[model samples]
Target: MPEPAGAEDWMPRRLAARRAVITGAGAGIGRAIARRFAAEGARVLVADIDSGEAESVARELGPPALAHAVDVSREESVAAMIGRAVDEWQGLDVLVNNAGIGIAANTPDTGIEDWRRVLDVCLTGTFFGMKHAIPLLRAGGGGAIINMSSVAAIVGVADRAAYCAAKGGILALTRAAAVDHAGEGIRVNCIAPGTVDTPWIERITRGYDDPAAARAAMEARQPHGRLVSPEEIAAMAAYLASDEAASVIGAAMVVDGGMTAR
Candidate 1:
């Protein structure tokens, strides 16, 4: 039988009517996630430390998508970001704590300042985001929280002591939060991606004498022989945020292309 005129399409809109906030959404993985969520019918708040970048992404997504400047490491900033989302959307349904930074240094070589900076943004920032958003999620009757961890948390990465520590903390936090809030209808989960081919990777590569060789070497380390794409991670995030993943709390969905299989 033919479909009626103006009827809904057969496509999947897994996140229809969801109000979501994605931090560090101006570029890379966060940007991809924001785009995916919007395409899936969710209204997104594109939050990032770079106001211009955030606004650009929000503009690209058109109406119902907003941009906010936020330093997720600061509790006050994180609070304001969440408050704005609730105010604009009348409630919150999804929060993606995707903001993070790293320092390239071994434990002994890593300075206290570098260590604190990485932890403050990568780990504590996630804490701040969840801390403020959870209350609103409860008020709205339930929601999903997706924390962006990394393969470094599960496998050792040379010259990334602070990053590894921060990501490891996120996994632990996700598990505890999931357990504590599952009864309240809230689901918490995480994504541990391997080296993603983002601008961040380009920057790291440029620091090497042979940028091409360095990038190739990095890709060779992956079992798939290529860095993961931000869009791949975004797809996983969309699943975790949608009703399809209602039973996926506390899970660390690895998008590492079998990086840990060996």
Candidate 2:
């Protein structure tokens, strides 16, 4: 893959000639990962359902970073996104399945539509990303796949029946994919994060009568009394994408400020 302009000096040789595809690249952890990967010399395809934000992020990263509107839940869309990556960057070396949604409906009150929507994006979407990305990675002699899971995957959380179920499925999916592909040189893993300070959390608290109280509740739940930053999660992601984490597979690295530890 060709190096983007102005990124020649700072790009790491380890990743300089590689290409990465990150879903949900419109904001938060996904955006951070795209920027970090581009800085390290990896050509990136920032895929998101929000085309505007995705394009903005890609432009900010300059050349070699392109934007594509992708609905990861759809097989055709995911295949197109992967095809674009291969066509643009020549080959793919990393896949970050970061697209997801969180629904707060309790199990009893959750509608079938809502349940399927959450599962479609968080679990099924991730599966599709892996399914489409595997062939590309194998064609390129193998690569890394990072799936974004959540602390809910490891623990039972209230008022998040669908979200938890989807996330839990992601944990199992990660392990299964890792075991099945390790011999083929593909490294599959998931990152389970606690409450990260992202727009998603902000939106979740917006309608609360006492937003402050709701925010406080979340903070109190974390042992550190604060939410994790997107950068912190991105640091771990960058490590996993690098050769440094060659042996890390089927692992769900947690970054929840000890929330699940309790």
Candidate 3:
């Protein structure tokens, strides 16, 4: 069985006293990151398009966490979300641009709308987050930004053309931002996750003729023979958000069960 979530040892409080905003914190990887950050002593703004989910996650994290409704694809919404964090904490230490969606279709079968939607959320959303958050980070005397990419960005996955393209864009963006801001003490990095066992994966498999078989196939393709857990990705985010990663900039940290190794 996969090991349970969280640090194996005592919590290191790596992010102690940090102020953070995580997009899409209503569920899955975002939620996990919020929880982990709270455990590490950071106050978090749990922002999500789903107000209720965001509220629930914020409440779960208690007084240190605030829930904010946000649609990352919209510039105004992204701006407001970051503004709230700044108002609440006076500045920001970390921003996790984790909101994203995937459309399962090859380029030929992909509709224009679907392509635009995927890019809007996955790629443009990251762009918006960085655009709005960078100045605040600069004002705060430097901070960290963790953008969520995917193995799809590093290796081609059949029928995920839009996802691949958007995630690929994230890596390039991370590199540019890292270079642009590194001298200012602002570090930018991305996490390239493998197929994580999240509700999103379940939703994706439902479209398959045999959801079980499809999930199994996904697992088999991973060298580790299991789906990556959301918590694992969260752990990486925590590390990147910490001062320990002071020298780690423009890096794409892969946590994919060795999916790209094959």
Question: Estimated TM-score per prediction?
Answer: 0.96, 0.94, 0.96
lDDT of 3 at 128: 97
Taking the tens digit of each residue's C-alpha lDDT, what string does model 2 give over 80-146?
9999987887778999999999888789999999999999998999999999899888887889999
- The lDDT-based order of candidates, best leading, equals 3, 1, 2
Clashing pairs in 2: none
lDDT of 3 by residue, 173-249 (tens): 99999999999889999999999999999998998999999999999999999999999999999999998899999
Q: Which stretches of candidate 2 lie over 4 Å from their true place?
A: 1-14
Local accuracy of candidate 1 as per-residue lDDT tens digits, 153-260: 999899999999999999999999999999999999999999898889999999999999999998988899999999889989999999999899999999988888
Pairing residues by index, what is the TM-score of model 2? 0.94
Q: Candidate 3 — worst ten consecutive residues by lDDT sum?
A: 1-10
Q: What is the lDDT of residue 94 in candidate 2?
A: 94
lDDT per prediction?
A: 0.92, 0.89, 0.93
TM-score of 1: 0.96
lDDT for model 2, on a 0 to 1 scale?
0.89
Q: Comparing 2 and 3 by lDDT, which wins?
A: 3
Error of 3 at 100 (Å): 0.1
